[model samples]
Target: MEKIIKEAIYIQSPTYIGSYKEEDCIFLLKDISHLVTEKDDKEREEDINDGVHYSQMLPFEDTPSDEYMNIFYESLKENAMKVAVNTLRICEQILKNKGNDVILVSLARGGTPVGVLAKRYIKYKYNIDCPHYSLSIIRDKGLDENALIYIINKHKSTNIQFIDAWTGKGVVNHTLEKACREFNMKYEVDIDSGLAVLSDVGRCAKIYGTREDFLIPSACLNSTGSGLISRTFLDDKIISKHDFHGAKYYSNWKDIDCSNYFVDYISELFEKIDTKSGDKYTDINIKTAREDLIDIQKRFGVDSIRKIKAGIGETTRVLLRKIPYKILVSDINNPNVKYVLLLAKDRGIPIEIYKDMNYLCCALVTFAE
Candidate 1:
């Protein structure tokens, strides 16, 4: 029993593909950010029209010119502490709402760091050692059923909360909901798909920390920001029935791993916080985001509600992942919008400067005939 348990320690498992190196924790994200190709105009049009999965292909990786890197470094230096403190407060709120015994299973790649950070906060603030698991949730393909099985067997089906970095169209939430339903049917286990995110620009999730659409700092870079794990893939050739989704380990990219820097930046700010009863934030305002998303969606036009991707984080994702027709900017003059403009230009997507968008920016998806 001891040997088996030890063997399973850091095992990628049948549902995961990457081997554990050191605990960078940003594994799958690092790979996807680098490997995924940009969709050309023709290719982008075909994808949006056909409703294909975008993860299968990667765009050319943008090597931030010296200017962008300088800006990114400056942003990280300035904002990492604030983000960490805010995240700690959010984690405390979540723990209070759910009770301290809840299990945190982060959607692999993006949510892992958030989960780890949240776990750290719980330990520092409340002395709770919650277990954090990073699992896969493919956009349309859904969460890995095998991962669900592993959790059920190991943890005996405790209260599970799904975590992510941010939501765009709430694809991860919807994907997990459907995946959990199928999992219950197959394994006779139930895991609530209700999610928690650092930000909710899509207005899809029930529990979240913030609605701010500003650059997450993490979104500005790929595996360098995440641990050096590749994106998860379900291709039959690479993944077998018993195998976890596959990801490549970029051992070569160790020099660029910002996982520690990101974590340390946020964590070091813990001393500055009061952690007192009245000063700490509670998620009383989560409802506002839901209403805000709906209002913005309708204002944009009920028909294009799906196209109106709000929040700076989501807009950045649209620029990265989807065929963006045009960018709706909240503050056209904001220097923060420059990166969005840079990537949009790379893909030939247009940016329309707007006076106001309830969120930071909205990306309209264009389908090509």
Candidate 2:
């Protein structure tokens, strides 16, 4: 079926909690195949480098076992209160600088929930509803043009602030900037490529909530934490030029879905927590992260920074989505890194304690080179 807001149409899924404001934006996307016959991590990597997009090659791993899921739940309980408060603080700074008329366009899948949380908190604190929309961005393929066109038509591109859940080695952030430049040059339209994320451990973005690199409980699970929506996809056959790319709405997984629950739960904590001024974490210049990434690449004899995903959130992503070669930890016992340690062990991967980095840990993705 279709959702009509003003004059725009968005085909939505029953699995998604409706978050669109009736006056501002259209969440346009197509419901496509959910199954990829799950591939082993190695296969996903090989396919990714061989001129095929990773999202088109595999389905995600099944939900983590109860033990791993327990780690995430515990993290949520321990960190959510303070984290929510800090999030509001950073968001406040962003709104202060950008003004209240900004729109949040989150990078799909990983970014979707972070955008939702920001929108919820903004409304709760300021009594002003911010429109949040999640759209697809593939690393090599660039941003989804059709979706961008749709968003631009519905809202002013100048007011759009792209959102991401976190910054790892800042690949997606750079990719976004490059993609926006390309979009502007190809179509002769301006859309801000500057991204705002809940965490910026990679030190890549200007507007960020925190740069702490801790486990964001939600980073511990797949699909379940994201409105039961599959990672965004773009294949020529599966997505036409004019369609808003595609994603599978996991309606069958609602009973296990914590997508909306995660956002709502965090939003509630905002009420109980004080929004006082604090420097729990602040921005780090991108130069440091860049120089270090290059050093790590040379030291490890690695082929590319693309394979060296740093920070706890990104390390978790390596375990979750990619084939992890090895994990280097500043502290194996860091409470924030419990999920990473568990994921490494569960996958039978090696973990090395090397304490010279800025982040809690770093994950060396399987280097296909």
Candidate 3:
């Protein structure tokens, strides 16, 4: 497929739903709120497992309660320093490997906040105003080539570094790798597919801040935490060849959107923590993690590995977006998953304690009926 050379529209903060400043990052996504048909979580999950692509529909995102918001704040307070340290480490590594002029292309939704923090770190530490943009990359549909072409034309392809908040089962990494290879072959340019993240619990990415599957508070909420933007959506009926992948801006959620608050809270701690002092390279047992995933599949009779979501971040996502069958936690008392516990309890989902698990927690999706 030849690369489409259409210029997709890019939106900045305030003009769009995100709370970040215009200079922080530009979103390469169309507002498709009017086109999206929001479905109940159970209905959406069933449709997805029945072979319907999730990108065809949106899950109804409820407004989090004050109590839930309190937990998010608590988690932020507890893990702010850790997040700040890792953000700096990831940014430093990017500069060292990709150079000062590198463009930070964060995978939409989850990666947006991390990209903003990274951009802030680079500016504060190196005084480099590197361009940052958030674009969509669906699981099976591949990346929005139009968005990639737009960015490549505006910036050097060699300097692009993909960013995300964390790795789940490394599915996105695989999707990104395959897409980048195809894009490079067709366009005759190399865009590195190695994803940079704050947490690499899946032990899949080559560049990461830590291998610990701790709570990243941003994962606690949906659009409210991610600049009030829906997860990237793509449907042939709604999205055109030239348009960027679609996303719905949660305009009504603006009053409670903590997107800016979460980033700024962590960014403030950047100066206090010494990113240079921590051990950037830690021993990560990818084999054990992979083995555990297989074991979970066998034990739970999960038909597809995609139904088994591992790690704190992934587990939270399953509870939030999918119809969770059950939640497996290494330690129920662990503060890292306080929000996860609350979510599971709220949904009346079954909880199991897996003491010998590789990741802190995991969530199993209900089989389609």
Q: Write the per-residue lDDT of candidate 2 for residues 1-369, one digit (tens) a residue.
A: 121123334432322322333232234456775433556766666776786667575465576667646766887898788568656866786687767877777787777777777777788788778777777888788887766766666554456788777787778988999999987777666677888877777788878777766778778777787766667777777676657767766667767777667776787888787645445555544346787788788878778777777888768767766668888898877788887888889899898887666678888875632
Off by over 4 Å in 1: 1-52, 55-68, 276-309, 317-325, 333-350, 353-356, 365-369
| Candidate 3 C-alpha lDDT tens digits along 28-137 | 88889788878886788689778889888887888986765876788888988989998977887899899988889999899999999999999988899999888899
Model 1: lowest-lDDT 10 consecutive positions: 1-10
Q: After superposition, how far is residue 69 of candidate 3 from its true place, in Å?
A: 0.8
Local distance difference test scores for all models: 0.62, 0.71, 0.82
Model 3 whole-model lDDT (C-alpha atoms): 0.82
Clashes of each: 14, 0, 0
Model 3: per-residue Cα lDDT at residue 316: 75
The 10-residue segment with the lowest total lDDT in model 2: 11-20
As for model 1, its CA RMSD to the true structure in angstroms is 5.6
- Estimate candidate 2's alpha-carbon lDDT, on a 0 to 1 scale: 0.71
Candidate 1 whole-model C-alpha lDDT, 0 to 1: 0.62
TM-score of each: 0.75, 0.85, 0.90
Q: How close is candidate 3 to the true structure, as a TM-score?
A: 0.90
